[model samples]
Target: MPPLAIMPVLRFDPAAVAECISPLPPLEHTTLYENHNCSTSSTKVLYQIATHHYDNGVFEMKWGRVIIICAIVLSIQIASADTLNLTAGTYETFADNRTVQITANLTDSTGYPVNGTRVNFTTDLGNLSASYNYTNASGIATVNISSWDIGNATITAEAPTATNATVNMTFVVGPVSKIVLTSILEGTVNTTHLITATVYDKTAWEFANDENKWRIMPDVKLNFTITPPPGSTYNSANITPPSNTTNKSGITTAIVRLDKCAGTNGINVNVTNEDGVDVHESKTIIGVAGAPVNLSITANPYNVSANGIDTSQITGKVTDVFLNPIISTGSVRFNTSGNIITKPLDGTGEAAISIGPSIFTVNVTVNGTYLDEVGNSTNLTNETVVVFYTEEPARIVVTADATRISTTDIPGVNESAITAAVIDRWGHVLSNRSVNFSTTLGDLSSTTAITDANGQATTTLHSDITGDATVTASTLNDSGYEINGTIVIRIMNESFVSVITNIEPDPVEPGGIINVTTVISGQGNITGTRLAAHAMLALDRSGSMDPDYYAGTPLDVVLVLDRSGSMKFLGSGPEQPMTDAKTAAKVFMDNLVSNAQVGVVSFSSSSRIDTGLTLLHSSDNKTLVRGAIDGIYASGSTAIGDGLADANSMLVNGRGDARKITVLLTDGVCNAGSDRDCSNAIAIANANHITIYTIGLGSAEYIDEPLLQRIASETGGTYYNAPSSSELRAVYN
Candidate 1:
């Protein structure tokens, strides 16, 4: 670019220049434009002014946001009339050419309609064309939509210059219908399916005539596409449509896919029209989550049944590799070739369906799953299964050591070879079943010799002084059960005595009370069935003060002695000094159960309430109590509470019995509750339900002489005592 030259001149028209600073007589509003601040522009005011020419004269106006209105005309400003409003008729909209219209809404400052003004219109999305004609005196306009863009668009119109006023509008472009959804069905696997779609004009044209409109396409075809869930890959090639219908919807089905093996398919299709429209829609098909069948059992448990004189039992668990039940929702049945008690079917979890004696055959039939819930499995295997049962070694378990002692001193019997064997109801020895024998000596070292399948054995007795021996049988199974019972016989050398019978319900139900008693006895060891159990002993201290207290306990004894007024007559020595009687009484306490659990009670018109139950303990308490007993000189008459009401209550609450027992030595009859005839008291004692052995010691006192026998018989306890001094020296043992 070279040098350029420019020239400037000023020929001011006062009329024109003054008009810029002045205004027409004020109408509604006037817009002011001037060149007075030219110093900021570094130029003359006239040089800074902008000029616009109307049809005749030129005027000075400013470019700004203010709208200008002229109340009167200045010079020959050209004015022509144009329709301010226009309405056009509707037409059918095509995907391509959607029709449109335009008009100007114009007026003078006085609100009178004016025409001959130019108007411009446009849209936010594509191009728009409109006729820029002056409005023909109306104040309205109409416009039509014609476009393929499937989204929203805003249309606008405005007048010329900074005074331009524009109106915007939005219209719906569709009921986009060409995209259609259809269905197809297939069984499974590479199953090919054919689908058809007929693409039509999306716009419904209300205005049409017997003229050439959108007719059948020369060639209609559409491309098919599909998208799958993330991480769920699918093949696009399988969705390819036939070549015949190009750019149109025809055999346009998507193929259903299947994996040769397993899993789920969540797939859908995407269809695109010639007009660039896309549609989407999905389905889930399953192929491999089916049930499995065919369970086979290799072993048949024939040995579990009863055979001959030596019957037996079989135990073991059966399982599959997956640990799932082979018999599905239904059950399995078993049948044996021989034996009668044996059933044709047995439920799961049981080792056998027994056959008489021993012989058995393990046959199994596996039922199928509930078909109603799950359809039959094509992979189902064999229907029959085989189970195997085997018998373990049979043994007649004996629970006693080899030792013989005289039965003379034992309270329950006159024989010493006390032992028990655990066998079936039929007398056959059970394998791995246990037979244990224990005695009160607490040495309790003995067992019923383990027998062979023959089911017979001998158990030698271990040297436990004298008491009851027991046998318990139990299996070596989880939550294995047990059965127990007792037999009493004397052990070691001692003078024989009358029998004291004590029986107990061996193993009792949970929370059940056990009734035990010493039925009859002279001077002998306190032997009874429960002695074999690690027992807690209770002795009555009712005035039947005898020199022989608990001469019968073998293991440990918890003595609960009664101290009612009747004991006053049985006191040792003449005049029955409380101190001397209690002193002589200490001698009998020597024959205690092993770790003697000694508890004492004394009753009068008012009996001693609480007496701690524990061990003889050889502590300060034992000596003090012994002193107290020695100091206890009788004064009142016997109030034989009768039966063992209080004693029974104590045992029930104590519950401290491996084998619980009470030695109720009452010499006097029950006078307090005797009117009820010891019947209710006896019932209460019976309800004590626990075994009680009585020691009846008595003089000719009315309480002792009258009811003594009844108290002894009622509690299953021994009644013993010397109402005189001379008799007290004789040891009960």
Candidate 2:
């Protein structure tokens, strides 16, 4: 046989073979082993064994194959997968040259350390220690991240040849850099002031968007304090919630109460940061002065001697609602039965007045007032002090409330108060003394009366005469010496022609014409049977008895005129509405009583107060009012409501005791502003009891007839329509 090949198979062991050959001699036989038909089990494998032997020495070879079963012990292994994990020393860091450590941990799935693996690091912000870091024996890789800019940063670590093995983390970067403090006072010293503190952090994100914008630091702590000024105690200044945390907007608030006279205070705020940041801000807060509400008065000597040279000082102290001394510029005025001298108040809110050389027993009344920066006066309570003298009556003095009285028999119209004062030899008042009163004219309320605590006795004098009356008062002193005092009262004769008017309809509607009947009557001394006197039925519709009967009441009148563009359409001279309006206004002013006050307001799309209510008693004042009326120039659209409003304002500021009247003249409908409805003007006029007399100066087509009528009717006034400019004077009359 040339060669033999054997297929390996599981068979009996070679050790159990019947014949076993010893180790083959050199070159005697050749044996070869080859694995074949291996099984799935680890302990079993097929091997092909071949033997080579030589026949004789001819160099010819013969091959023999053998099948053997192998029982082998093998070492087995399973590969482990790589893993990557990222961690940070801290999630947050400040821009104050501080940093946070980022670590990358790499390992196998079997929890075995994977060393010598390079981890690639990347970040959205801040500086990194290294871009690539190798893992140590512990399978941990680390890098440091730091930034001067404040913002958020994203960090990543990745290993090569790993199944999507990448790890990421977020780092917050910020630091408190700046603080701003501000304050505003809402009212007086006792009121509260709102204090605002803003905290900020400069960051890269903020810079990228807007360099001027600051990155707000939320949840930051802050402390607020206020430093009081001079002449004020620390207790006078208090801030509530002194410690607070900022909101999401980076702002915090505190309330500060400063009760001081007047001065500048310091407001301070400090930022509290975890990174030990020392940020502070300060501002100046000016103190406010409170209103005067309390006043106390005292006298050096309760009683000053009547000796011609004795002096006493009266002092007045003022305080505010908080009981804090008023440190403002003002004075205390002193009034008394005698002469008084006044002086300005000192910084301590005390003002002094000196009274000396008393001639008789008299009481001194002292009062204090405060003048603010705007010169608004506030009056305080009044105090009284008496100057004493010897207690013996020596002189008697008498006074009358009115030296002139009307001859009419009216109770309040012709009555006068007569008073008598009794003094001692040393000018001391003597109370409980009997006084005798006698008058040459008029009737006395009492012939004798006892003096009161003030050493004064009062009596009433009723007169219907026209001549001067001398009243005498006499009293007996302690020494039985008669002291006499006399006063003169003049009762003048009354002469007037009253035109009694009667109206069929007691209440007439606005713009309605009616007939009135007049009857002339005379009182007092009428020389002839026929009396000639001019009469007018002009009456104030605002709570006034007919002027024809009660004619002495003072009047406050405001003339409102329309200077719209249409007024200029009628041309100049008598044909011009503006010219007629001026003329009619002047004529009405000329007819006003001497005691009447007049104010002028002109409107042309707007309104202006030409002059305030001025007394017509002086010719110069009357001339000024007339000049204002003449200066009006017509232009712009018509604003009737504005004219009425301006007129109402003027009347509201007028004398409270006078009859308020508004004469509004308009040539066109209200078409310029929202106030054209005239409802606001009407409401205000009615509330103030002011009568509005509306006069339509042009044709019906150019004027809002219903609006004018409504304004007048709603305000207890009358409305008149002037079809032509010539009729303006008649309408006003």
Candidate 3:
């Protein structure tokens, strides 16, 4: 008999289940336990009930006990594993009711196919053919899905009875159905127009009756192209954004711009579907002619003879606001007096006519009527005056394009166009005559030129010299009399005026006040009748002007020499003091410019003129000064006051416009004359605008240093002391 108690539930690791069940009897006669929710790595529980005993006929229930049993049953169910997996044939598809096949695979934890299992399907977007399906012999369940809406679709498959047996996959759905292109029908040439292509997608059949069946497709790439009208020489239509993506509104735009001529433009848009199929749409834009904004009339040989043999060409032109010629079908009607003629426009939108000379001046009017590519008509009118004259070569007139031009050596910089018109005594122009041109101070482009139909001959004159250029034109008439015409062109050079202002008392110090008279003078080659001049006076109080700042101005200088008895002594040098003084004086004279004048005054007991103010403008004048300096001798007591007075006299009567300067040298005090105090002489020098530079000769003890310094300082000059005769040359310099 078997034990009455039921078999205790036993737990074992899944890995050990095979080991624990191996002790059972042969499979045909063994009792088996099946687990409906077992995983590969999870713990499994087993329960068994037996009515018969083991081979020994004894009941045993213990760990690791041998089992003599019947068959064992196993049902696999993985923990958190995907046994029912859903997959699509294609991951992406168009929203135009495109169908995608989905397969759900069912398998056990041991990789054995699970047959006869039901799999249920669900989706977040789109539709499934069936909500529930059963696995076939291969453990695969299949279903069909479709969608009209553009979005991502999630498909889920689940085995309801199995533990953790569910799976889901995502599919992409987009739009690629049709495109509709739209644009304005009419547009002007040389203008931009907007063209739009609206894209849409197809939905499922269940939404066929609803307006939402068609959805907007975004981020779809589209390509645009343009086809010009037939018979066009060039394709003038341009499209911007040849390839673009659609916006959120499913609309893509392209700008089509027309240029030059009016014509029809065909716009095409192409889009490819996910399956590599291309769809196309087209629109036509008519480029029409704009309104005739401008009309013009012209006549060649405006001055024509009354003789019928001479003819003039009259042309009329039509243009749009954009300056494009309107070449469409059009006729120009030209009216002169009571006579009228009609002519068709050429390809350039211009019509021309030939008219004979009239007795009286003729005024011609033209009217134009044209049609654009769209059959719209525009009318415009323009008028021009024509001069008709009798033929003869009588009176001649000459004129210049520029009467005054700056002088330049460059070929085109200074040029004047000279034209000569030959006319009859009745004021009628004559044609086909040869004329000769001549200029006084410039070169002519051509010496001779033939008159055109307008009875005018032109020549270009170029000059590099500044002066009046007299141009003459001469021609022979029918009567063999020479007809001459003359005109003048002034070739001017650049000129500027300079105004110099000088104050009578120059360089007023920081705190000194004195009456000053400013003398202003203007000098240059600028001449004009009744031309008033303006000048400004500016004084620089810095007193840092260079000695040569006035180098260009003529300078008058006087040399005051000391011929006292002490100067005759030979002191500290190989040469006598008198000799050194003479040598230094000559050196100073040599340093002056040719425009500078020099005078010499020698004083002992009294002062006497050795040479009057003489300019060294020539070698002969310089020789005279050198001779006077060499003839000087030292003698008698020094009378510096008398010497200064004599030097001032020479300068005061000298060149009125020259700068007055005096260089005085003395070795002794002013002890020989009543003017010894030298105050009177100093005052006279200052009043005369004279600058005095004084040098004390010999040693400091023998020279009157204070008197020399006073003389220099009082007259805005400098003082120097020569300790020896060797320094006399440098001191003078």
Candidate 4:
């Protein structure tokens, strides 16, 4: 068999041939020619058979014919192998049952388009418009696909004529169903936090082993909205894309800013798709306090007495550089040069402490910390310090330069000099303190004198009456205690002349000078001079006079009281200046002489006649005056001049037969009304022949000493400076 050339015969199944050729055009009969050669040893002859088909039967086959037919069939199978290429118009769509177009291009292996080819289409998810499609004259086939369920879908196209001509595309189909947020759960105030929101679609489906299911959607346009918690805010610039829009992946990111006092803050994120499907997610963030940067300390009363028993309050406040108060439940420690006591801070970041009554200035220092709930402590960077001073006063002494004197029956003769020295308990002389001088049976040159640098105060006393006169010197110590000293002096009337009178011609004409002569007999000595007197008393009831500064006295007098607002400060315990003045006036009325008349006038910014001048001899009149005084209350401003004018009016209109006098007492300056000038008041007293006695109570700073002195001097009266209530009682006596 190897020696001889063997010919291979091509065989074909009739059913297969029929099926493959059914769509082809029918072949016509063709005759084959033979070629012959006659020469030499052999003659060769070749004959080509004609291919044909009869209506009824048998067919003839030739080797050359079989070869030609086989070649044609093989070429057609190769061209159909790569004729179709599939592509999707869009890879993503919503699961709302919307349709998408899928296309397949028909082409041969040489890249030449093959028309009239049948293409088959299908999807792993959803449905297609048709399972098969024929390529058009342009060699392209298209189908519409849709999905009712959410998921990813795979679309495939294949040419039925060619086994290797196939193409597939994946598409996403769904609506937004869920959202997720990712961020830090806690952060400091005024800080930034990275937040991310991921959008998902519950209707989206994924395919595995020909099965379809829901999955995350891709290539979807998502919109995001962020809602910050209370006391928190967001940064517009920190949002990606600036419009809070998600890309095809359905994700958005932003940075949020929290407030300074943020407590437990939560952030909410909402996401929606183009189809109007939405979802939400939330996250909680814890806010922390800032660091402390400064501390301030203060003392309410920076100074106290060195009696070693007083205390002061020390407070400290903690804050940041911005001066915002630090809210914490922490304690602060206090240090001092003397003694230290501690207290915790309140909600306002303030702490109070008690200090000691020491001799030296106390330097206080404060240092502390603020703690947060997370056990973080912030120390104060600045140190706070405060100082307190302690002061005290000790004792006083008095002396007299001359103790005795003698004078004739005159007004201003017998004079004695008195001196007072203020000495501290340590034997050191203290100056600038006031010493008041009073006499029981005489008049003093000056009622008040301040101690000089030498710690000495001097005054002169004079009396025309021959008797024993008592002089008192008093001052108030630093502790509000009274220090007093007194001395008695004998006044003897040593006049050398007795009563002897002569009249020129026993009588004289009007406006003519008459010669009068008096002779001294040296027989009788005059001891005292007596005169009837009428007096008015003016009193101040300013707020500072709220203390019980006076008691009642027995005298035929008009009580004028100041009822200014400052009188509220006048009194001790339950007795105010007005109340005390009323008590004193009532007592004076009780002790008045039977034939004496009493009245009452109370002045503030104005004056009123509470009780008119009435003889105390009548019990009914006394009751009426006392009741009026008791009804007086304190209000308004101090009107010294107005008060004096009113008192002068009462006395000038009263019983004319009585010698007139006025007493004025005030604890404050005249501060109300045009009459505060006081000159008019003095002139009125002088015109009425009323002797004015002025009493200044309290410190020199409060009383107008020069004005009081002028009023008393012009009226030929005395001025008394009562530095304290006890001294005032002595003045009344």
Best by TM-score: 3
TM-scores, one per candidate: 0.29, 0.31, 0.32, 0.30
- Alpha-carbon lDDT of model 2: 0.69
lDDT (CA) for every model shown? Answer: 0.39, 0.69, 0.70, 0.59
* lDDT of candidate 1 over 32-135, digit per residue (tens): 43333321232222222222323213343322222223222234232222223332232233344456554456664445664444565556754465524343
**What's the alpha carbon RMSD for model 2?**
24.6
For 463-531, candidate 4 gives per-residue lDDT tens digits of 777788888888888778888878887776654323334445322332234455543333124444332
Clashing pairs in 2: 392-424
The lowest-lDDT stretch of 10 consecutive residues in candidate 3 is 51-60
Residues 590-638, model 2: lDDT tens digits: 8998778998888888776666787765443564566567667788987
Report the C-alpha displacement of residue 335, candidate 2, in angstroms.
Answer: 6.6
Off by over 4 Å in 1: 1-142, 145-178, 181-183, 189-246, 259-265, 271-278, 283-435, 439-484, 489-733
Q: Could you tell me the lDDT of residue 210 within candidate 4?
A: 30
- Report the Cα lDDT for residue 178, model 4: 63
